[model samples]
Target: MSNTQQLKDLTTQVRRDILRMVHKVNSGHPGGSLGCAEFFVSLYSDILDRKEGFDMDGIGEDLFFLSNGHISPVYYSVLARSGYFPVKELSTFRLINSRLQGHPTTHDNLPGIRIASGSLGQGMSVALGAAQTKKLNNDSHLIYSLHGDGELQEGQNWEAIMYAAGNKVDNIISTIDLNGQQIDGSTDTVLPMGSIKGKFEAFGWTVVEINEGNDIDAILKGMAEAKSKTGKGKPVCVLLKTVMGNGVDFMMHTHAWHGKAPNDEQLANGLVQNPETLGDY
Candidate 1:
């Protein structure tokens, strides 16, 4: 798993899984999920200091909360492939009574999911709470969370941002997927939040920017730096610049795929681009 090439291959396969998962049910978000493939693969395969099994309270292990839960395709794929569940369970995505809901839910007590997330802007608050809980328990493992750049429009996230800095939640690493696109057109068309790095710095966070987010090697290196910044008296924030629909040419650089699944032809096209690096689920 430490091999960068192996992780990149997994990233390609995760993209295949995202495309196929969304296309199978004609539901779910694919843009952000595709954009975050490298992050998820890099985190689970190379970065996280995790235990061998799943539990609600992840003591002595690093934790991850998907703030933008709509990207459940990537989350679910990585979790299953990483042994949180059977990889074949992915076929049940978005089906009634399935653990893989449109957005991740804990009602099924799905392994590797601590909080239900597609409700944008709440993940930071949840992740911060977990970070603080680790502090209270005298646990040194870091807490990680990902947020959509567009989701920053939510007032609750800003409040959480302020609280994290003010409370000195140094045991957490919050990464913003700065894809600049959301469900409704580009983020600028919706609401422009200027200078994310400046905002985080002004709020007293140590920020790291990963300009090449889709590259697994860059992610591993940048996340390592982010992890090293932990316990240094300030929370770390990684601004990961990514393409909305990264691996698929037709889907790239547009918000149309944000919440839309590819059609049969589009799915075939995307699969061709990604290839089945690791066998399909």
Candidate 2:
């Protein structure tokens, strides 16, 4: 299959897995998971090298970190479907003793996940630190990190951002899910991220805005641009404008469903909009 088609198929399977896993556990943040499905698909399909399996230190391989752990559904699903673990393990999500916790953690020794990140705002620093380590070791591999727009409220992120720019941490690419909605309500109502692009630019980092973050083609294009900007002596940040719940209408336009799993009826309805491309996990 072509890279484009493969990414689309991966996204479909990811959406299916997200629904089934969340429905089984009766909890999860499907809204963000759905919103970022295409982004993750493009990352796993077009970027990153995992043929030798993932390592915590990730020597000689690109690394990725999830700052917003509530969206673990998409991360776990992508990792499983991309061959990081047995796809069947998805069924054990959120169950006691399951490595796939409600939030991702390295303690479980999950192959793909490198750090625990439910606290938010910390992953950027972690990614930056990891990138610095790679540079220190003279490794050419890049580091990637994902952050929710709301997570920017944490003071640590700004410190990390400043540190990255000041210290020339150019090998890290940080993408923010700027869906304009968090767990509470509209981002503006909760904490207005006024001129996010300007804020990043002012921080001395190269910034790119992706208006169609939910579309696979657009996501690929945006990520390609992000990759191009890497190693240019400045950190890159892509401000992704995504809908809270992208594929399903009822779940869109609000934050009420941000962390709520769909009931049986809702799951059935959502799955209707997204066909099972690689079979449900």
Candidate 3:
């Protein structure tokens, strides 16, 4: 069993990692990365049935794909802390020739990253294909994927969504980081996506809503419920409502910080708000 306090502590630490990784490089996306800290921490720490080490062929264990790969800081941090690689490697984030890039890439052969994302709308297709492969091999383990709500603007997602449900890709759970704010502005201002839940249901999916995407308890329960809904002849979609830049008071509720790295003073302030719970890498 995973302890709530421990999960919370890990979240705080992951937030710290996101902030520091972005601040160090003076580049990379921090807003979405910060927003999804809780989900990433909970997924790695308590949700996915992971194996002992990393491999390209994940046969028996659950696999996770990040479609919105700009938020690579949180993903990299969680993978490292989960023992996929040395936590110290986080310092190389966005640095020249580093495995960690502005967006996740398989070119570096990063242990935890299975696919190169950030083009948007393509992750769903890749994940669906992987889920299908799992089924073919008779592996009962599930496949999990995360996408930015804004990425839905791409027409490819709808096609994938349609395909997943039409074929009954029941071994996958796809979660949307429904933080209303995207890069240019609020999703409504940039481009409003009407009723994600309704859309998924219309596409023939089992949908669940997590009202508090930042809360560890909510993520744990929501994910458990999502797991239960799988393999019932429909893919599961989780509408995770999150506040962009969740941990830092100054960064919350705005799209301005989406890809902007914090300055030294700003970084210090953010660090104060999320004091290190697990040691910084």
Candidate 4:
């Protein structure tokens, strides 16, 4: 298969993983997880220059932090499929004493998780610190992070934005998942934070826009462009416009499924939309 087709297949399987994981638990975030399947698949499969194994102290290799940790289903699925851990462990997600909690946590020492996220607005600061550390150590690898657009409402993100630009933390590429929908409602209805691209540019970061965040080809091209823009005296930002629930027809473009699990019938329907490519765990 061609590279793009391979990525697309992986994305479809990841979407299936997301739906099955949440449905099995009857709890967990599926909307955002489904929406970001392409991003996760493309990043881990093609973009990152990762080493053979996982380590908390990720030195001399690309690192990624999931700011919107509610979508642990996708993160765990991608990491597992990428060989960070066994894919069978996905069946235990959200179960008591399972390393795969509803949201990612460091307390359990999950192999691929570097930080306990999902608290919102804190991941950028943590990524910045790591980026700065790479700079100090003369490490040349980059740091990447993903944040929900709604999460920008937190004051801490802006502070980190300002800090990164002012201090020239150019080794980080932060992306905002501009799905335009949050838990309560559309971001415009909940709390309209105007012009994410404008705000990032004003903060002195180089910004790129991906109008089709769900498309693997678009993500690959946009991320490559973002990488080219790095090391130019500022951090980079990718404004990714994505649908809340992308692969499943019924779930697409709605916030209702933000944290809801599918029933048996719904799960079956969703799986039909994305045929199992890598086999289900």
- Could you say which candidate leads in lDDT? 3
lDDT of 3 by residue, 10-117 (tens): 999999999999999899999999999999999999999999998999999999999999999999999999999899999999999999988998898999989999
Across residues 2-82, which tens digit of lDDT does each residue of candidate 1 receive?
Answer: 798888888898999999999999999999999999999999997899999998999999999999989999999999989
lDDT tens digits, residue span 38-71, model 2 = 9888888776654567767788888989999999
lDDT for model 1 comes to: 0.93
User: All candidates' TM-scores?
Assistant: 0.98, 0.97, 0.99, 0.99
Candidate 4 residue pairs in backbone clash: none
Count the clashes in each prediction.
0, 0, 0, 0
C-alpha lDDT of all candidate models, in order: 0.93, 0.88, 0.95, 0.94
- Model 4, CA-based lDDT: 0.94
Instruction: Name the regions of candidate 3 deviating beyond 4 angstroms.
Output: none
Model 3 deviation from the true structure expressed as Cα RMSD, one decimal place: 0.7
